[model samples]
Target: MKLSLNSFVVVALFAQFASARDTQIPLEWDKKVTWTEKYGPQSDQPFSGLLSFSHLPYTRCLENEATKFDIAVLGMPFDTGVSYRPGARFGPFAIRSGSRRQRATNGYTMSWGNSPFNQGVKILDCGDVPISPFDNALAVDQIEVAYSTLLDRPSAEGMGERDITRLISKDGIEHPRIVTLGGDHTIVWPILRSLHKVYGPISVIHFDAHLDTWEPKTRYPGQTTDQSRVTHGTFFYLAKEEGLISNQSIHAGIRCKLEGLADIENDESVGFQLVTADDIDDLGIPEIVRRIRQRVGDTPVYLSLDIDVIDPGLAPATGTPEPGGWTTRELKRILRGLVGLNFVGADIVEVAPAYDSADITGIAAADFVHDFLSLFLAEKPPSVGPPAYREEL
Candidate 1:
């Protein structure tokens, strides 16, 4: 067989394009911080930990513990509350596997500030909470229990009967920062319950395709189906009713549902703000960030990210795919804009791998999760100025 000159040139051009595509834009933060490879499980070093969830560490929130790490990565691995899909229960495992293949460090990369590792930030994958299939209530209960242990209250405050003084004297400390991986959006209820119990009056920044304010039961007429009758749509309402959250502080993204528009208009107590799909173009990214900041303020923010907030074409693996959702760049910009605020905790929910062929959704979900942590962790600790020097001279 003879190859023509045109064919040779076409192949050469293809090689050049592939080479360019393979290259990544070098990160700017790499110059400021010292980078090191991790040695064991969850560490950036070569190890078998990231590949399998079973080997991931589940450390106790004691003063000194075996698996003590600063930023604990927990897997909620349950989706029973979902009224639309059953596979999100497998989300945590899929995300973990994806992280291993992606080969990115689970720690903060120094883009805007110092590396989290150098700043005493630790990251540990605390494995998944045990889950029961198709049982929303049980799943929520288990998640609460798992997080309660992680929160680490003293025995006097109804924690496990461990010797407090003895534990505190050691290196490990309880009440460490927590980063959660979710099975579905309903998982937010339990996490909020736990965090609110510890950090009261916490504000929430919700990224989703709906306001998620629908009452589980409403009197609206011609209601063929009560959209909020199940766990999928009633998380916020439940949180509000239980007094676990301040309704005024909630911010939602790209909401498109008209099911509860009248309810929002008539309600006084629940002053939830919606950044509807129509507003995305008119308001723009900076304005959206301003609105979120205005609504949330300096209150300790809890970020709840539902993958469905992205357009279905970009994220088809979610249980409820809504059109006209935020683009990836927009989401990245929004998250980056949230830096320096008091972010107490966060969760990335609703990633179902069973629906996608290329694992693109999971990859996007992982990177989004990574970027959220990076931005939050890289934030500079508020400066405490030195004592007044007027007397010096």
Candidate 2:
């Protein structure tokens, strides 16, 4: 039986519409988000009840309670530590606001091979840590104090018999990863300090343009001691000297030393396996992952991503924008490469939301955060409960 061309055309149109609806539909996996109306009274508003930011209740851990999050996403808005760019303190909120709008999509392309789907990853935005408006010195102190509470050891201060039992039983068990949004690149120092206190000797995957190894104690003249104390430009030197991280496991991305390669090679205390922008072009991203994995293996890795690692053409909202940086596609590929690694903590830093047009930098930064979380979640057990972000549903 020959079907008419008009009948065939009608059938094709129906199928196309159905496919579009399916693609646009939000995934129903996030079962914890409870959305509500804000501002107006319950009667006057379109919806009742105030919106709760937390997706999960406080059933375990003291650190979780103080931040009002099972997994807190705090922002460190400190850029006074930077030598080049000054207005990165506003990075955290912009990144969060931009990421809050993206739904699940197959962001992976065929060039990266068959990348697996992200499983149940529970991430929450815990908001930004307070900073001093007038004083740069006070801002660093404030961030340290705020982060210290989150990194505090478990306590017997307010625990019942049941709570004590749970604590003892779950001792040595790592829970609720912290995804910190940054004000400046230096904000990662306190976070790494916290993570090192709990999960010691973490391997750092430093993605940036500069080596950031300048210290007051170094031979470089005119570098002051006060400047080396807790600034954004010199965290690597501090981390090495203070023994927060091992130099052997540090991998730097998109580097260019104007003074020559002597600085990086001479520093025995900070041995960076360099992945220059040209290295990405010559060897490709798969090789980039292979090298990163070789050095850091399956250890508890901390990913410190600077948005300035992207070209100014792509990401203009950073303090110091490099000329040849990773493309969005390449950056995503690198992230997908680290999916199975044991990542305890991570941060997406140096996104100055105020500098971009239509918040494009914020959008890119947020998307990177989303991709990182996706990779992190891909490692979780398959049978666990759904993700904790269901407000979109």
Candidate 3:
């Protein structure tokens, strides 16, 4: 490889971080978020309820969930696929709880200079996929079918719909964009398979400390069954077999240990370019962004972020906690750089909050979700591109 990856850290550097502000709901929020007594209370206030992510609740049948919304956040609670720690099934819940403090009134972010909430994009927290705990095969089917159903739905408004590569649907209206909360990394296989039916093969921006493209035949040699071959460690291998990947897929913050150099060769064979975690320190955010943006070109992109991509020291609730990883801020800044990519779907996985200290890991994941919303709603900055965004649904 031209770029030397030092000891090849996937360390995106998510070590111990600033503890959250006093988590108690502030009384002053009532005045800012709630309606005065003369008028009724603001029914949309987010801090005090079991509603949804960021108090943005829109619970309905899956059909209704996608029809009116431009973007929806769905959760897949399956973690039976993990090779190690197994509490990521609770990731969606923890991320939502972490976002309790984010209300529309205070949703403005300094980076993008706008509030993602109430930005004319209908966003909903579409709850979790009721995956079967006992049956891994059945759970896989459930995730694929569930994601496909929503992707087929048309929204009331179109944000960036492009039919040049793949048709959004019949009549060519925009299909809603989905921001998923994941069960584990294995869930990405079915998502890519499902997306393949709509967008054809997709380029992926994978953020992880490990290169998860292990060949199951070698990694799990004793297991020969169809389902046995696809653990979180080997699902990308499965995706590769299914012809679901584009050559442009790239992995950032990849610092996981491997058996030998052949693993990197194998990873490249699976259609991924690597930018090790230490590369962030050497090249900085802008160059990393430029590399990713140039690599994917105009392909429909799917972003899959493994929470372990950040230094496990900071965000330790993931299945495989590698020591060095990206810091929460650096990762978010890099994500912001992806403002104009043709993003079709995205997910944050392996955030097992049960192991968290002060909920920092979950809070960081929720903040990434917030960044995603702004990315979906906001237009690309003029300085960034000539190949613009397509509002499909």
lDDT of 2 by residue, 1-393 (tens): 999999999999999988888798544456553334222432212122221112121122323464333244667777777767677888876775565444334434243232222232333455567777566667766766666565452332322221211232224633456667888877766676776766676778888876666554453456565644666667777777777776556554656555655666644456466778888878877677778877887566788888888887889999888888888877876776665566766788888877787878888887777666555555332222122211111
Q: In model 2, which regions exceed 4 Å deviation?
A: 1-70, 103-122, 133-138, 151-171, 217-220, 266-268, 380-393
> How well is each residue in 1-393 modelled by candidate 1, as lDDT tens digits?
999999999999999887776575344444563343322333533335535322334443432344455456788888767767768877886677656543333343333333333444455566677767756566678788778667553221211221122233232333555677888888888887887766676678888886666666563234435333447667777778778777556555656656455767623355477776666789776677668878877666788889888887888888878887777767876676666556767888888989865877877887676665564554332122111111110
Q: What is the TM-score of each candidate against the true structure?
A: 0.72, 0.71, 0.84
CA lDDT of each candidate? Answer: 0.64, 0.62, 0.81
Residue 111: error of model 3 in Å? Answer: 0.6
Model 1 residue 381 lDDT? 28
Q: After superposition, how far is residue 120 of candidate 2 from its true place, in Å?
A: 5.2
Clash number for every model? 3, 0, 27
Q: Candidates ranked by lDDT, best first?
A: 3, 1, 2
Candidate 1, residue 362: lDDT: 77
Per TM-score, the best of the predicted structures is 3
